[model samples]
Target: VFIGLGVPLYQGYGLTETSPVVSVNTVEHNIPSSIGRPLQGVEVKIGESDELLVKGDSVMMGYWQDDEATRRVINDDGWLHTGDKARIEDGFIFITGRLKDIIVMANGEKVAPVDMEHAILEETLFEQVLVVGEARPHLAALAVLNQKEWEKFAADNNFQDAEKHSEQVEQAILERISDALHEFPGYAQIYQLGIVDEPWTVENDLLTSTLKMRRNKIQDTYQDLIESLYKK
Candidate 1:
């Protein structure tokens, strides 16, 4: 199944000032779809804007070289203002989206693409997907398959060729994606998926060395293919 090396555990929050991780998930009182409670030494509170604010022993003394930056985040109450927007419900924390990733649909729906994209990935048809067209009525995705494994499968099946195997890869992914998407709402579902024959790699500048995609670059590189997926 799709899983992470760690507990993916939920817990404490952190700031750049707090050395990045201050809280983590706890098993005793875990909540689904929630990043568990705060760490023992950290203090958390909802700010006027409902943004999370934290103060703790782990909190840095101040910005090392940027004094003005330091004063701006730490208030008279000594709370370090974290720019991340989140909310607490039933004593659990839910981060709607990053400040940058949040999108308001034309119908007033706040869509978090990662939420739906993760659902698509859960099917294993794709190694990665980028849900795009924010603020539009419908959702779309750029999906890249796990081609190496498909290539190996092709040999086992006696396809004897990369081209034949590639075709199978596309068909297999399309069918799997269709089945996996049954749980999504119509608007949230991926109406079309742009398929890329080429894989993403840092050498080609499609991704970072760590493999995080440069979404805008990939979209531009495959613009024609992407729009074609939406064609009737």
Candidate 2:
């Protein structure tokens, strides 16, 4: 086993139009959360829409024989529209979430689901939190627990009653979600949460074949569960 000691290796990002690497994370100084700094020959900038744009030699000359496609991404100034949303802090870039998946509330406050997902996963027991409340006023989440931990807790308590076990599970999930994210701002807090019996999977069409989440599919399938959780 390669027992390497580090939080991050390097931040690397690329655009197809750019034939070469745009941004690469530094191996020596690893930034845990950020994607790392831009590469030597790359120039990175963020537009008002928060989309990360790159202008560099690494950029592709243009779309392959597709003038229309080339024009949309690469402007006359030779910047590639990366179509990625990123946050720059302390001279480092961090990909918060996808621009398409970004959620903007009624009050105009923006929330990236991955940012809150990271917050929820701070606790080891926090298996997953599908940050919902898209187009709504505030944020909410559908949290799933580590089933093995939940089962072990139930067994340790010697609680054979099904009703009591269910109650304990709900209480435990809620308490952990609340305490796990105490450091977050109020709007970012999980206003409410619900639990799921099964984990997300591709077999049920809730995830991609590679195991990445298919957010829209999951949201549609669990619409009622999510709605009920937010109703309270």
Candidate 3:
């Protein structure tokens, strides 16, 4: 029972150091969220720290002009230490997140924001979302809504301007996101929402060319919005 909005998506995982692709799922063997099994001739294993390690011909020789950095990542044993924390189950690799991106909430709860963001986006109308709650009591999100969807919402709701950030709009979005997150853990649910008018793009430095979120850049760009989410 695999349902998709349109065409099915198969996730793959790799880094620049690994010639870009270490694993991929084919149409014949797709697992919704898993990154698939390691490609032929590639050996992947989880280290004691839960970091993904790769060994094989696809791995890069070394970092250019940075021997110390290269040595730190590629050990003498020829294993390329990938910073991503992941798990291997039934021959599938499920990437959790970067070692540094795990949020430690005030109550000592560990929350992986990416997992929450994925769940939030499943039913919400947002085009992009980021969960933030590093040392806070509860999580919050910065959301970028689909422009066309927002226009339709505004027209139906009798809003004079779709661009305006109104209370009615915020409440509607919160309700939708809340419904999507009902099954998530309490610590992972978003308590606040910050709506951004502009879409994240590589031109704006918010997203990489590969469409990955540049988390640090986005956080810096929306510093005020993030602070407001924490305000009483």
Candidate 4:
């Protein structure tokens, strides 16, 4: 939305337990940016703590005969507890982030790093970004620059050997990221940026086969860089 890409897109939110779809923005009754109202016969509500809950026929009866496992997710009332965090306004659902991925800063500020990471990726300069500041003062990110785009950036800036690390290159990358984050609030802005030398891959154990990042692994691999980001 920041760059006005002109793509007619609609976002939806759901979990596998909800038959994979609970709320989706459709062309007929679309709220451009919202996850739209609940589907017909599907009821959705944000629990007291802001967790999204859904109940309806579309929801699975149980986890394929595993009552013990099913009971853990579906309450006696039959509401499916989607692990996602969200808010409902005027019947539309707006997902914030995953409950588990929330980061709490030292000053009691809460930030969702995924939101920041996604906004930065919209610039297409970074292929991967993991925002981290749990229990720290401010937000920091481990970013893997898109090699092709980085090379173009280097060429445009009259630099050589773009693959090699340089302070000037880092600053240039940060500038692009900063521009991409113009819509984020001050507290959510990235305070420090760490350029990751290698792209995350399943072979490197940084990513799962499904392509999800292994957060713990990345943190362990970049422990020193993470510490340097917050050095006095």
Ranking by TM-score: 2, 4, 3, 1
**Per-model CA lDDT versus the true structure:** 0.69, 0.74, 0.86, 0.84
Candidate 4 ranges beyond 4 A from true positions:
1-41, 55-80, 87-96, 162-164
Q: Using lDDT as the measure, which candidate wins?
A: 3
True-structure RMSD, every candidate: 6.0, 3.7, 4.5, 4.7
| Most TM-score-accurate candidate | 2
Work out the TM-score per prediction.
0.61, 0.77, 0.72, 0.73
lDDT tens per residue, model 2, 155-201 = 87665536432645566566777787787777766666676767888
Off by over 4 Å in 2: 1-11, 26-36, 61-72, 88-92, 152-172
Query: Which consecutive 10 residues in model 3 have the weakest lDDT in total?
Result: 1-10
lDDT of 1 by residue, 1-232 (tens): 1235554444455667877775566768866567777777887778855567888888888887988988988887789887666787766777655544555567876666666777778864477788777656666677766667556656665654455425454555556666777876666666665666677889889998888778778878887876766563
Question: Which candidate do you rate higher for TM-score, 1 or 2?
Answer: 2
TM-score computed on alpha carbons, candidate 1 = 0.61
For candidate 4, list the clashing residue pairs, or say none: none
> Candidate 2 — worst ten consecutive residues by lDDT sum?
1-10
lDDT of predicted model 1 = 0.69
How would you encode candidate 4's per-residue C-alpha lDDT over 1-232 as one tens digit per residue? 7328866777787777777889888778777768888888999888845789899999999987699999978899999888788888889998877877888899888887777888888987789999999999888889998889878877998878754467677677778878988988788878778888799999999999999889889999999999998892
Model 3 local distance difference test score: 0.86
